[model samples]
Target chain A: MAQLTLVQALNEALRHELREDPRTLVFGEDVGRLGGVFRVTDGLQEEFGERRVFDTPLAESAIVGSAIGLALAGWRPVCEIQFDGFSYPALDQVITNLAKYRGRTRGRAALPVTIRIPSGGGIGGPEHHGESPETYYAHTAGLKVVAPSGPAEGYQLLRAAIRDPDPVIFLEPKSRYWTKEEVDAAAAGRLGQARIVREGTHATLIAWGAMTARCLQAAEAAAEDGVELEVVDCRSLVPLDVDTLSASVRKTGRAVVVHEAPLTAGFGAEISARLMETIFRDLKAPVLRVTGYDIPYPAAAVEAAYLPDLDRILTAVQKVLDY
Target chain B: MPSLRPDQLKELYRLMAFTRRVDQEAVALQRQGELTAFPPLTGQEAAQVGSAYALQRQDFAFPSYREMGVAIVRGVDLVEYLRAYRGDWNGGLYDLYAHNFGPIASSVGSHALHAVGWAMGAALDGGGKAAIVYFGEGATSEGDVHEAMNFAGIFRAPVVFFVQNNQWAISVPVARQTAAPIHRKAEAYGFPGLRIDGNDVLAVHAATAEALERARAGGGPTLIEALTYRLGAHSTADDPTRYRQAAEVEPWRAQDPLLRLAAQIDDEDFTRQVVEEVEERVRDLRTRLLSAPRAEPEEMFEFVYAEPPATLAAQREELRQWHS
Candidate 1:
């Protein structure tokens, strides 16, 4: 076992995938010589050569669209979108083309592609650098969207996404990329499934990526105040492990959803709606959400106010309990 | 080794002619209450057909909606293609066996990115297959197109970006699209870019074949701007006469790709035979298309996902019960 940051975990997973299967390719802006702005793909171009791990032009649409073509030709491509806000230009391809290909082809074709996006806020970065656009892809019908909270899960889930038959939108918590965790390579196979990171009986806090860590911290903090919270990491967003989530919510009799995406049409709404429908009678309180405001991701100085942190999660948990 | 034979060249001529006739038919059909719209590829046959014929069976292709000619050359049935313009489910149904030759993308320049990504994947898998993505002059302004080329250049993806610069992006000319030559955009992305006489089928064929070969050999991506013209309104929905002079259209007709190729075939007899065969094929395809099974009004709700959302499922049930 070794302690690794999320960036190192991704590098390890990519290195392993490249060695095990030559089909995996890593390329994007600054990913080659710079090993990515976040260095998640650091040292890959050197290890694998420019052919497999190289830099791309500053075009997001081409990055996503070309990945679809390459997959059709029988390759598993891993694309790096530099930041969350920059993915806007590639949205047409991601939503209209990449997400719809598998279903449009009706199983005749499988878009075996993984798009790695370093998303969410908290890095004191400039505009167009810190935003959450995962809701757009998760709202899309055909894509398999996933986010991992820590180094171990990042390594495991990335390998799974590369191996999966369908297209996977892998969103890294850019804010948490440098956060370290003791990762067990042997536990990599357990990545795709959701986990009950912490168990409590009062209410369930469902989250993923960076927010999952915050939720766990919130749950721990809430315990001292006598509000026992259950924290569940939603590892896979698309093929949502509804069975596990529903069961947990049913046991706890209360629910609180958290995410960094805008609240207007974010994924938390979907989860809350599903909970209201399936576990309505079991709820002891109204399901609530602690999410980023329904506004554009702001500058880094004010992002702390916008992103759902431990305090926000606890506030929502307490509100739901009081309800 | 040349994959194409003399007969294949003749077949290319026939396909190009069929594309021309189909353009005329689609215009007539739109006027006769048969279609909602038609994107005519009237004067750019060589750009579409030659690039299409250059592809091998393993190669992939992505087309914008106006590329009916490319679809025909890539083995998609002309009738099936019409269904797409007609707004039917069958139009979305793709033929995967012919190397995933499918319908055109309606979202302008976005498919160019899809093409690059797919080709990059092919290169990674050691498939040694190339991909060709077709777009228009207007599409060059799109961020997706630029992104695709950038990625293709960096990764050396086996893809060819075929831009049919037919001069007008629906009344916006080449000057509105970019100040720099479109081919030069490829150089900015680190690949060789070529501008060809798009109306010359021989030149189009030679350029595409060379680019495809370089890609298959893992040399890198290529960008080709096929300089040509749009002889008709952008689509049935447009009227070019209001924006451009009629004299501009007159010069392009003389440089018509179909006629140019028709004059260069090996023999006069073969050229004449190809003309008649194309006419026959067009007539048969038009009839088949006109009578093809229309999409059921309910089919619109199907195939959004592998399984429709529970809400959609409920809505479909509601529609079914209401109809019943």
Candidate 2:
């Protein structure tokens, strides 16, 4: 095991899958020679050859739309959508076809298609660069949505997603791509299990994707104040490990849902409602949410203010603890 | 005549006549409140059957909701194919892989991308097989169709873009759908496009067979726009009298695909034999459809995913509990 960044680990996982499965294909805009804009797919085309790993035309819908067909044709296509906001152009294909194909065909077809979208803000790039579009995917019925916090989770979850028979929307946190962690390549894991990153009893800070790191930071800060916080990294959002989430919330008797997407109708709402439904009697206080404002993901300059940081998470944690 | 033998011409006549009769029966079924709705291929029989007939055993066909003739040609179970109109299933109940046909796509023009993608896969697998996608003239207006064509061109994917220009997308006319002819759109994608008389079974079959051959030979994609008229209402739910004139319908009646094929064959005994065979098959289809069992409620949750998640499982269990 070596210390590798999330992007590097993802590359390793992709390489492993490519070596293992001849039917697996990796393609997207700039994913071939350019190695992706974030360099996550660096050296893949050179290693796998253009047939297994190649570049596609700059059409998001076609990338996903063709991936669906490729999947139907018995190829496991792992496609990328360039960025989070760019996924909207392919939403029709994703929501209408990819998500419904299996149900449409009545289990006759299994689309092992993994759509990778570099998600969340923190790089302070221009508009449409750093939006969190996970909620749209999570709400979709026939899709499995997952987000990794760091290197190890990134590598393992991506591998699992590729192996999964159903379609998976793998949201890679752009902000956390450069963060390094030692990833065990042989480590085995499943898709719907949540990992408790930190153990505590004062309160549980539930989050996924980039916000999980922020929650860990908040937990660290809250510990200084003599209030130990538990942090749960919800790896898979769709087939939610409600047992893990409820167990953590039940132990703490308090919960704070966190995400970077807007507060209204976000995935946090679903988590908050689930917690309320499952562990209502075990709660010490009402579950609070720390999320981005309902407004559009603002200009890059003001993005830091829009995104939920340590201060916002800690404050929400403090409110739940105080109650 | 050069491409098709006399026997093959007789077979084409039989298939077109079969499709025309089945289509008429389906419309009647809808009128009798058996089927929820059906988009009749009343005028586009030759275009659907001829192109579908040209597909080799290894080749696949992606069809829109209206291509029941394609389904018939592809040898899909007629009872199973009618399940979608019966509102008994999402798509039809046919085995897609076995028949080498995809599910009926109600979302117009979306399956074009799937066809191209499948063709790309076939090409990548280094096979001689090709994929054919059927849509109407109006489907050209969709962005996915344009993207499918563009991708097919760039990748040299083995696909046939078969557009049955049946003149109407519901109430919208061909003129409203595009400025130029539908086949000319292929020129921009760096491929040859053919415009043929959709009512002529022999012409439709030859064009599709040639296009399929080119595709299988790695000649990239071809677009064939078969010009015809929507001789009836778009669907059982639609009314042609509201949008079109009777005068316009009168001329297309003379150019009916089945009538044209029958005139070409010109054998009264042959036509009677084809009609008898079609009637027997339709009778069997009606019996099977009427007798088909209603799907279990729990089955609704089964096919959504290969491994249904815990939440979906729980919901399924809850449905069972409610029933119990």
Candidate 3:
């Protein structure tokens, strides 16, 4: 085990996939010599040569759309869509084309496309740089959505996404890119399995992507107020760790879903509704949700208020515990 | 003009005749309520058939909605092909890969990206296997088409962007579609562009063959704007008299691709045989479509995924129980 940053672990995962399969390719805007805008693909072009790891023109639709074609041609393409908000330009390809391929071909063809998006707002970036778009993808039928909270999951999830027979939207939490953690680079975690980061009894705090770390901090903060909380890192959003989440809620009898996106129609709502439906009888309180307000992703100055934080998560926990 | 051999010329005539017959039969079927709707390729048959005929057996082609002619020429199973228009399947035909064809995309200009992408993959395999994507003049307005050409040009992907400028995108005419010549737009994407008389089967074949060759040789993508006219309503559901004048279309009668071929070839018996064959094929399609068992409700769940996800399976059960 070694302590590597999230980007380093992702790089290692990509490096492993490239070395293992010649059909695997890495391409996006500034991915080659520039090593990507975020440098997640740093030294990839040098390490694997230009043919396998290369830069593409600044066209997200073509990047995502062509990967679909490449998959049909028996090649595994890992396309990077630069940033979260920028991925909107390619959403047409994602929603209309990528999601329809399997259904269109009637199970005859499988598109093994891994679309990597660096998302969430914490480091204070421009308008289009930081946005949480996981819900939009998770709602899509043919796509499997996963977000890593730390370096280890980053390494494991990206690798697994590459090997899956279906399309996977690997949402990389940009805030956690530098958060160093011990990682077994070889460990390819199964998709849709939740990891209970910390176990408690009074309440369950569930979060994914950038909010997972904050949720853990909130659990610690809640302990000071005589409240013990279970922190579940929801790694996979689409196939969802519903079983683990329901079990945790069944144990604690109180659950709070946290996310950086808006409150209404957020992925948190889906989780809360599921918990209410399946394990409502076990709940000591109504499932509470701590989420960003419904507003346009504000500029860098007011971005903090726009995203869910530790205090917000703790407040939701206290509210659920009081019930 | 690149001259066609005796057999090649005869084959070209046969494909056009077959396409024409199929167009007539499908329109007739739509009229008789056997089919829901169909986009007739009456005047644009040569544009579809010639370009599709140019591809190598392994080379892939992506077609827009009106490419029934291309599908017919490729020998895609007619019964399975009609299942799509029969409202049984969302995608047109089955076993697209076996015929070296992509699904007939309904969305405008979308399949261009798929074509360019498949072409890139074929190029990587390094065998001279090229790809062709067919779209209408209206589709050029879509951003994905521009991006598709851009990608194909930059990567030197082996693809032919065949634009059948068939005068109208439903009610909107070519004049409203673009300000400049359609073919010249390829220059912006750094590729060679050509405009051909799409109604002329020989010219369409020659231009398409040349582009496919250059693509196979790794010369990058080429844009071919086949200037043809749509002789019928956009679909059986459309009424064209509202937007266009009958007088305006009267002149294209002499320019019909099939009529031009009939003037070149003097084999009356061959034409009669081809008409007979097409009639037989249409009859066979009708019989199969009628006899085929309706897709079971459970069949929807089976093909959704290689191994169905938990939610999907659960939902399928919900549907099955609800139906029961």
Q: Pick by DockQ: which candidate is best?
A: 2
Q: What is the per-residue lDDT of model 2 for residues A241-287, given as tens digits with 9 covering 90 to 100?
A: 99999999999999999999999999989999999999999999999
Each candidate structure's count of clashing pairs: 18, 0, 0
Task: Quote model 1's TM-score for chain B.
Answer: 0.95
After superposition, the stretches of candidate 2 with alpha carbons farther than 4 Å from their true spots are none
Question: Residue B160 of candidate 1: its Cα lDDT?
Answer: 92
How would you encode candidate 3's per-residue C-alpha lDDT over B187-275 as one tens digit per residue? Answer: 99899999999998888999999999988988989999999999999999999999999998988877999888877787888878888
List the lowest-lDDT window of 10 residues for candidate 2 chain A.
A313-322
lDDT of each: 0.83, 0.93, 0.88
**Best-to-worst DockQ order:** 2, 3, 1
Ranking by TM-score: 2, 3, 1
- Regions of candidate 3 where Cα sits further than 4 Å from its true position: none
Per-prediction DockQ comes to 0.44, 0.86, 0.72
> RMSDs, each prediction?
3.6, 0.9, 1.3
Which has the higher TM-score value, candidate number 1 or candidate number 2? 2
> Positional deviation of A318 in candidate 3, in angstroms?
1.1
Model 1, range A1-323, lDDT digits (tens) per residue?
Answer: 89999999989999889888877778777899998888888888889898888777677777777777767766778989999888888787888887777656645667778899998888898998888888888888767789988898999999988887777899999888989899887665542467999999999999998999899889889989988889999998877777688899999999999988888888989899888888889989988889999887788788889988777788788788878
Task: Put down candidate 1 lDDT per residue, B1-324, tens digits, no spaces.
Answer: 455677777888888878888889888988998877888988999999998988888887888888888888777876767777776743355565554575567788877776777776677668578888899999999877777787778778898999999999999999988999999888798999999999998789889999999999999999999999999889898999889998888989999988787777757887777668877887897788889888765666665555554456767888888778
TM-score each candidate. 0.87, 0.99, 0.98
